[model samples]
Target: MRSEGLDLFAHGMIGLNQLKAGSLDSRNSLGAILGGGMDIQIWHGIYWRAFEADYVWAALHYSDVVSPSFPDLRRPYQNGVRLRTGLVFSYGEKKAAPMTAACSVQPTQVMVGEPVTATANVSNANPKHTLTYDWSSTGGKISGKGNTAAIDTNGVAGGDYTATAKISDPKTKHGGETSCSAKFTVKELPKNPPTLSLSANPTSVQTGGSVSLSGLSHQSGQRSGQWRQLDGECRHGFRKRQQRYAEYFRRPTRTDHRERKLF
Candidate 1:
């Protein structure tokens, strides 16, 4: 009984020694390689056959192992050795699209001519997605376009005009179009719409009730506004990111680069 107890203790000791020499010490020094790990007897006592598992902090792997020892291990007997051979397993993941850009098309839906401004408000504040744009005219008579570059709806034909706007990132297909195209029916002009007068009695004219009218029609100039960042955070990691995107169509617009610190 005593001898058997000693034998079990020896096996446990041998296992600990093998563990230290094999990976634990090496792993501690290799924190860069994920410091935590464990070795377990995956399949043991199968007639001299034992499959050991190596859990390296994140991944699980198994290996066939052989531990050879000697009876006279005073100075640790012969060349005792523990051997390991790898087995196989696999893993993978699908990445989701990050939020890229936001846009606004004035009039969103419009008739030709009048005037239209397509504003593509963009942001990559999150995990740095991508922001992009393109512009076009629907009616031939109406020809005038611009983006953050320059917006001008000078002249155009009369029809439902849409300023197709698309936004996305470099990785996948994510786009949307909208229009604030000012629509015009080109109505006949009217004079003063009327004038001003005071009357108390309907037909008797009591000189008390008063009426006044006025209106001025003209181009409100292509829509205008300034771009601003609403949120500022770097959760997935704040990095100075340069993202590129491909569009079915591209427009050469004005871009400004300055010594601006964007945190």
Candidate 2:
């Protein structure tokens, strides 16, 4: 396992002093140590401590001065440095799991000129590191950043295509990359023209009487209607009304006895 963090410790040390009479004495003192270091893995559960350096501070009291005639001769405070290195044995250290990515599209099917969105879901990723997302497609123009992208289906053929996303962590050196793919289809628009039908309520009308005419039109999966009146072989007074699926025309018959033709 590789590890690094702050260290807070209480340390004790013994100091030996030599007197002018060739005798030796010892003194004990306590101090606080604060530092940090890193360990690199050499094998399973075994690591080498690269380096550890700490700042040491302690106060050594030798004698007390009661008069201004004599100054203190002992060092009141002392600063020191400590360096160390060793091997570390760790137990039950857990390694990070491999990264995994899953891709999804908002619409599995769409018509030409429409847009589709692709998204990425990642697992076992390090939250402290920044992630990069790269996107590509077998068909259409795909563009995005981060976790989501937009696909332009304009001018693309009507068939199946794949959208893929690659996720990567720049901070990791190994097992930091993964990819996923999702399939989608594009459909072409209908090519047939709209169908229309026209009918009259009465084939023949008496002079000074009224007649009703209607028309219907159908296109694709929708229906719309529009109404208009035109002068034919016989002139007549007409009025129009619109409806959801049909159009109606109301006209007053004229006294002229000529044969009337409507188209």
Candidate 3:
């Protein structure tokens, strides 16, 4: 019974029983019953309460029967049997939540050459837990583990950034998460580019005749369409000559080596 009670204490509940029945006559009797006083630590609960049985041998038939000129054959005292058994069961519990979390970055505003920082504080802790840097609100970076961190702006600038953190416990399946942010601004430089001039003294000239050219040679624009003497080519001191034509020349089909004079 003590063992049964301890079993009930350690494992919850239990059903225990012991059988002892028979007479001191020729044949033994058999019987069993469900009885365990309140002494059992087994709590009252719904259970099948399995039964048990056992049998032992003893010499009573010849000794008792031979004594009183034939003992009562009806009572099979030692010839009968007794049985004992126990009942108990085990079950599972319910499902729990997982550890989840978020990390937040600080200073939602920033400029070129400024420092930024983020923190991973434990928002919740139960059963078991751990912390991790999941990501940032600005899609920037992640931290391995820790509570706080400082960011450098040496090579970063002019934009918004965010940081995220995840505190979790794979065991208890629960956690807390958060995020933070910052901003920055960078300065830019200006541009300045030169001018040019060109000139030819006269407007018209004969073909194949030499024309003096004058102008400023500067690196202001990318390229120059300075050929063929356009309308704007004579802006300065360049010179030009008059043109002349031939009289009584060869027919249209004839080719001549004579240079047409300019007027």
Per-residue lDDT over 40-150 for candidate 1, one digit per residue giving the tens place of the 0 to 100 score: 222221112223322232111122232334323212212233434343222342232344444454554443334445555544322343434454445323333333422
Arrange candidates by lDDT, descending.
Answer: 2, 3, 1
Task: Give the TM-scores of the predictions, in the order they appear.
Answer: 0.29, 0.62, 0.31
- For model 1 the local lDDT of residue 166 reads 48
Off by over 4 Å in 1: 1-94, 98-103, 107-115, 121-126, 139-151, 171-263
Kindly list the per-residue Cα lDDT of model 3 for residues 1-263, writing each as its tens digit.
Answer: 32322332112222232333365332433333323322232443323334433344333234433456446532334333454455554345232343334445556555445555766555435523444444334433333446676665555535555454544344432223334333423321112222234455454566544455344433322222233434544422222321101111112311222222222
Question: Which ten-residue region of model 1 has the weakest summed lDDT?
Answer: 240-249
Which 10-residue window in model 2 sums to the lowest lDDT? 248-257
Segments of candidate 3 deviating more than 4 angstroms? 1-16, 20-92, 127-145, 166-263
Model number with the top TM-score: 2
Q: lDDT of all the models against the reference?
A: 0.30, 0.68, 0.39
Model 2 regions more than 4 Å off: 1-36, 42-44, 53-83, 204-241, 246-263
lDDT of 2 by residue, 196-230 (tens): 56677786777656667665444453223354655
Better of 1 and 2 by lDDT: 2
| Superposition-based RMSD of candidate 2 using all C-alpha atoms, in angstroms | 10.4
